[model samples]
Every structure is written in C-alpha cells, then in structure tokens.
Target: MSIDSTRFILLNTSHYGNIGATARAMKTMGFSDLVLVAPRFADALVHEDTVAMASGAADILVRARVVGSLAEALDGISYACATAMTPRDFGPATHAPRPLFAELARSEHRVAFVFGSERFGMANDDVYRCHACISIPTHPDYGSLNLAQAVQLLAYDWRQALGGFEVAPRVPDASLADGAQVQGLLGHWQQALTDIGFLDPAAPKKLMPRLNQLLNRAELSAEEVHILRGIARAIQRRG
Candidate 1:
C-alpha cells in the first residue's frame, strides 16, 4: 500500500490537542491524509491546543477534512481498520497492527485507520463496519491509550511495514585520525604529561600505553588530534 493513499480518521474527537498531536504523528511517519468524523468542536482543526501540539505540522491540519459522518470520511478509501477494543460478542476479527500491516503492504488498497473519541471508544456499529479491529496489546490492568498515542503507534507500525525512512545524522561526520596522527598526538600528550609532572620518565610504566588504549576506544577525529596537540604545545610553553 502506498503511504500517500493512507488516511487517519478520528471520530468525535473532543480535544484540539489530540488533533494537533495526530497531525504531528502522521507527518513524522510520512502519512498526512487526516479526516475527522463529526468532531466535538467545529474549530478543532485550528484550535490553540491542536496547533501547539502539532509542533511544525500545521500543513496537515490545513489539508485535513472534516466530515459529517464516517461514510463521508471513507468516501475514497478502500479499507478501514478500527482501533477499538474488539467487542466481546460481535465485530470483525481482531488483529495485531504489525502483522495486519505486513499483509496489507502487498495490496493496492487505500487504507484508513479509524480512531474513536477519548472518553468512549468506537461504537459497536463502527467496529462492525471496519474490515479489521486492531487491539493494541497493553497491560491487562490498563489498555487505555491517548488518542494521539494510538494514532502514532499504528502509523509507525504501518510505516515500518511499508519500509521505513533512512536515518541521517544532523552534523557531517568528522574525519577520524589516521594511525600516524593518533601516534603523533599520543607522543605529544606524553611529553605534556611528563612536563606537568604527572608522568615520570623513570617510572613511566604503562601510563602511555593505557592512554593510547583510551584514545583508540574514543575513535578520536583528526580535528580532535590537532586540539590535543595544541594543548601539548601550551603545556610545553608553560614549562
């Protein structure tokens, strides 16, 4: 299933923060089609708490659709999965998110994950309408989940099944010190240690070897080697 074709649907959501948090969750997972089925407040799409919780995903709230009913929200969607605790006597077969999502990944279905209100979960009718009811495994004593948290967990699992995004580091990786550079730095530090009276040449023992092991473990970068050499120069000047 294409991430672009997936939608997150919320029914009768009572808090603006939930709407905002949902937008943030969807954006992080590379899914953004959001639909609200008769939310408690008309301004929920742009409420202060919603915007605040959304962080930087306001574009999702702007494109989100508000509909009168679940039918309207699922107009172009081919599949719907209810994120409600399965009804004891009735409703569709309950499935765990990861396995169901893996199965869905092969199909071309335009899927939707439907969530219910915070106070009361989806009604029996809502669970019955969905193709599958997803009961996120939680502690037996408490399975209650925050509306945004459920959406996030479901979205994350689905995204992983569809193939996750590549992680990138914020800063460019520094060039590591070559063997020669590390040796040079070690020699400089050894001199500085002796000059500072921290290491005695007659009683050197394994001090330099132990320090060399520490630097090797640190994986010092070329720039770090230069900095250490500079400190060694300062110590020599002081002596």
Candidate 2:
C-alpha cells in the first residue's frame, strides 16, 4: 500500500496541458513518480501551460520521464493492468473502483496501471501486456474520462490502498535507470540507429533532436536504460 512503490503510467498523451494536469493530479494525491509513454508534446510543456496546470504540483511535472513504447514504458512492472472503457479477454469491465483497489491492496507486488491516449484507448497487443483492465464507471451514456481525470481516479484508489497514511519519504525506485547510464544508452541508440541505416549520417539534422525528445522524455532510470540498451545491442549483434 506504499504509494511510492507503485507506478501510474500514461501512454501516448498528446497535450502538454494534460500531462501537466496529470502531474498535478498525482501530486495532489501525495503521489509522485508518474511516467509518460510517447507523449506528443515534449518541448511545449516546459513553457507554461503544463506548469500552470500543475499549479503546486509543478515539481512532479518537472520530474516526469517520457519513453517510446508501451513495452519499454512498463519495463520493470511485475503486475500490470490496462485501463479501458471496454473489457478484453483477460478480465471484465470495472464499473466500480473499490474492488480493484481491494485487489491491489492484497498484493505486495510492484504494480503499474497503464492508461492509453484519449483519441484511442489501448491496442490489442498493449492489452496483452496487462493481467486485467480497470474501468471507471460513469453515466453509461457518456462514461469517457478525460486523461487527467482518469489519472485522478486511479490516484485516489492508490491513496485508499495506503489507508490515508502520510506520504512516506521519497525512496528511489529500484527499477529505474540512473541518468548517466540512460545518457550512455541514448548514445548507443543513436549509434545503432545510424549503423542500421535508419538514420542518414550526413543529413542527420533532425534525427538527434528527435531522439533527444524521445529519450529525455523517458527520464529512464539507470537500470531500465541498461535493460533497453542491452536489447538494442542484442539486436545489433544479431543483425
């Protein structure tokens, strides 16, 4: 029930303001360690709309990490659930929130609840990554939740899991990669991409910038970054 150990990841957010709002939502609930997967606005959020939405939760927004794929985003999670408006093969739809939190309370595992973009929920392959799905009930006619609102709902459940306990001192997530290691992996990724001819060497103008946007947004921990770099190296070795 310690909130620090749990991860609430947002996948493919398009708006900087929503990202900021999500950050604010988490912070308001005494939760931090929010992760964004393939966020559309990497640069624009730094200006102001995001900060304004964060309000007092600006620090959480500042500390957010962005990553590329859902697989990579959920790299270290032991228990994963994808939130959806419709249910899939693994589980039925959740019209209520308490039972889900009740399940979360019983397990001492490291869990991550993944939310997809507003435009499209989650892909079938992405849903395959999770053990189940969480659905927030609303008026059956119009139950869709805004991105930030969805995050707020999950954050509230996480708070309940803690039994209203005071926010514990921030402990580093053992799963995330350190900054230096992530930097090295980024370098390796660029080099590998160029080696594979995915990037043009001479005309590599926007390539690094794009890579920076992708990698920097992840803010990957040392461990996660190395795991990813290892995959990249393996691919190169295999090729």
Candidate 3:
C-alpha cells in the first residue's frame, strides 16, 4: 500500500518536457520517488521548461534524485520493471503493464519502474538488470509511444492495481466528434488532397467516401479532429 517505496527511474532522458511530464504523471498516480540516470541535460529537473510542463507536480521535480549511472538508481530496489517495447532474444520476459502491476502490487519490497531514452529504449544490459519487462499493449503497426505517455499508462495501471485514486468526472455529452464534425474533417481532407494533387476533383472516384468511412471508424475525439484539420491546413499551405 506504500506506493512511495516504488521508484520511477528515467535513464538518459533527452527532453526536459518529458522529464517534467513524467513527474506530473507519477504524482498524479500517487508515486513520488524519481531517479534520473545521466540525463542529457544536467539540470533538466530544475529547468524552467521542465517545471512549466510539470504543471502543479513541481514537488516531484524538486525532490528528484539524479545519478551518474543506472546502478546508482537501482541501488536499493528489490524488484525492477523495464518499460521497453522492443523484444530481445535474452532478458526479462515481457509482460503487459496491467498484469505486471497486479503482481508487483502484492509486493511489500521496494520496486522501480525503469524507462530509457526517447530515441532508443533501454540498453540490453539495463533490460537484463530488471526482473521483468513491461510492454503496453498497443497497435502492432504503431506501438511507439512518447516517453511521458508511456509513463502515464504504466503509472495509471499500477495505481489502479493499488486500489486506484479518485479523478474528477468528465463533462457530460462531451465525447468523440459527432457526424457533422466528421463530415467537416472529410471536407477539409478533400480540399487538402485536391490542393496537393493527391485527388483529382474532376476524375474523383470513391476515394473521398472511403476516407470518410475510415475517419468515421476511427471515432476521433474533438482534439483529434482539430489535429487532422491542422494537418490538412498544413498540406494546403505547402501545396
């Protein structure tokens, strides 16, 4: 029940925002201990950008421990879990985050969740040092997640396994975009395609409808719709 005993170790973190976001994610889930192993920026934890990105979780950043090596980070850890999506011929067996957290939740000993650099995940030796590997179940074609997102997912699952924390209710009736919004997105895509010469308006086949169907199936949220629209605008600008 003492989640504080579990540490969140970040190795060679290259981005200040990621470090800050990781702190926010850990604090949101009630986990505090953070260890950074030779981060790219020596003062990332205290950087203004990092503090800004941490939102209201700056306390975690203030108390974060920095070490010169992974060994130092794992000094007192009883069990360690490496968050690495890639498979290795040798090393700890990869387990999905939920089940792994469920098992770790029962342990009273100190535990650590180890994450690696954004460009490349944990080195083979580091992965080998862990008792287990945690891979968040993601689409096979696109399994890559940002460093902070990965931390958030694992933190959320681990927190849930530890009886979970209360979160505020979402706004009522605020969900994925409705039909009109989808259509608008499709229209934007159509113009973008035409502007980029990807689709010939005169000789257009069923491509637009097909794309519309694909978008509909995606159940895009309002934010996603806005992102797609922004992409379309970018395409138009470039065209």
Candidate 4:
C-alpha cells in the first residue's frame, strides 16, 4: 500500500495553532495528505499563529487542502476512521490506531483518519460517516488527548505499519462500510424506530445511543448495513 494514499483530516478545527501542530505531527511520521474540513478560521493554514506552531513543518500547512464538509474531504476514501473519546451508541467499533493501521497497510484503497475540532471533537453525524472509531488507550479518569497528540499517535502507527510492523499474525477479513452508507443505514433505522414507537424523537434519551453502541460493536459491512436497512424498512411498513 502506498503511504501517500493515507490522509489526515481535521474537522471544524478552531485553533490555527492546533492546525500547525498537527502538520508538524504528520510530517514527523512521514504522512503528507492533510485535509481540513471546515475549519473555524478560513486562513488557518496561512495564519501567523499556524506558521509559528508548525515550526519546521510549515510545508505541510502550505500544501493542506481545506474543504467545506467531511463528505467532501472523504470523497474518494475507502476506509474512514474517527478519533474520539466519548462513547457513542451508533459509532463504529473502537480500536487502537496501531492495529487498525497494520490492517490498513494491507489495503490499496485510499484511507483517512478524521479528527474533530479541539473544542467539541466530532459531531455524531460526522462520526456516523466513519467506518470505525479509534480510542487511544488512556487512564479512565483522564482520557482527554490533544488534537496534535492524537494525530501523532495514529500517524506513527501508520508509518510503522507501512514499514511492515505487525502486532498480530493476520488482519481480519472484512470490508467496512463507508460514511455515506452508514449514515443512510442510521437514517433508515431512526425512521423505523420512530414508526415502531421504539424511539421517541421528542425525548430520545438513550434508546438510539444504545442501539448505536450495539450496531457499532457489530462492525457492519456495506452488505450488512443494507440488510439491516431492509429490515428497518420492513419494520416501518409493518408499523
């Protein structure tokens, strides 16, 4: 697999400093594809603060692509993973980036690891679009990680994976669902749950969240999402 096919996407990044730091982190790990999805500051890549933070890796900031949405950023990517600490009901299965990278290294398709804004992390909608979620192992009482720190960890893993690092004997045989497919499946389920009176949209407490967790653990593939959505449609019609 070409290491150049791997992308590091930052979504709704608010601080130019973080952007710069992220650039440096990626460069240190030999990753160059940097895409910023709707950063808070339009001039983040060129800002003085960003330049100052990037230090020696300003070349990455200069070449970074800025886009309007996550979908746009992930247009041609086959596998997309989200990095976040907050557990979700419908989120992808959480894995350490290292093993995930090792598996990804065997694939020829384009891949992306998306990180949310420093302030709020990724939105549920954005997280839903990813094929998997990565939670950096940390202390239970304090699991918060800086945006750049997270990038560095994943980038390092990808670099190692490219260099033939294997934590296990073999990667699993599975094709993961992309963002749009996952979103459609979730939408179908949401409607079905509403029709069945299983989810009160007005006061949706933990029902959908619980279901998200369940589905994420299932690691549904595209075919599986399609099948599940079919079942959801059936439930909608029956109700």
**Top lDDT: which candidate number?**
1
| Count of residue pairs whose backbone atoms collide, per candidate | 0, 8, 0, 4
Per-residue lDDT of candidate 2, residues 41-75 (tens digit): 76634758878888888788667777888888777
Ranking by lDDT: 1, 3, 4, 2
Q: Write the per-residue lDDT of candidate 4 for residues 103-187, one digit (tens) a residue.
A: 8778776889999998899899999999999888889899878898888888887788889344664757668887788777877
RMSD of each: 2.5, 24.6, 12.5, 24.0
TM-score to native of every candidate shown: 0.87, 0.64, 0.69, 0.67
Q: After superposition, how far is residue 6 of candidate 3 from its true place, in Å?
A: 1.3
Q: Across residues 134-185, which tens digit of lDDT does each residue of candidate 3 receive?
A: 8889997888899999989888888899899776778765479989989999
lDDT of 3: 0.91
TM value for model 4: 0.67
Question: Model 3 off-target regions past 4 Å?
Answer: 167-239
Clashing pairs in 3: none
What is the C-alpha local distance difference test score of each model? 0.91, 0.77, 0.91, 0.87
For model 3 the local lDDT of residue 209 reads: 83
The total of clashing pairs for model 3 equals: 0
lDDT of 3 at 84: 83
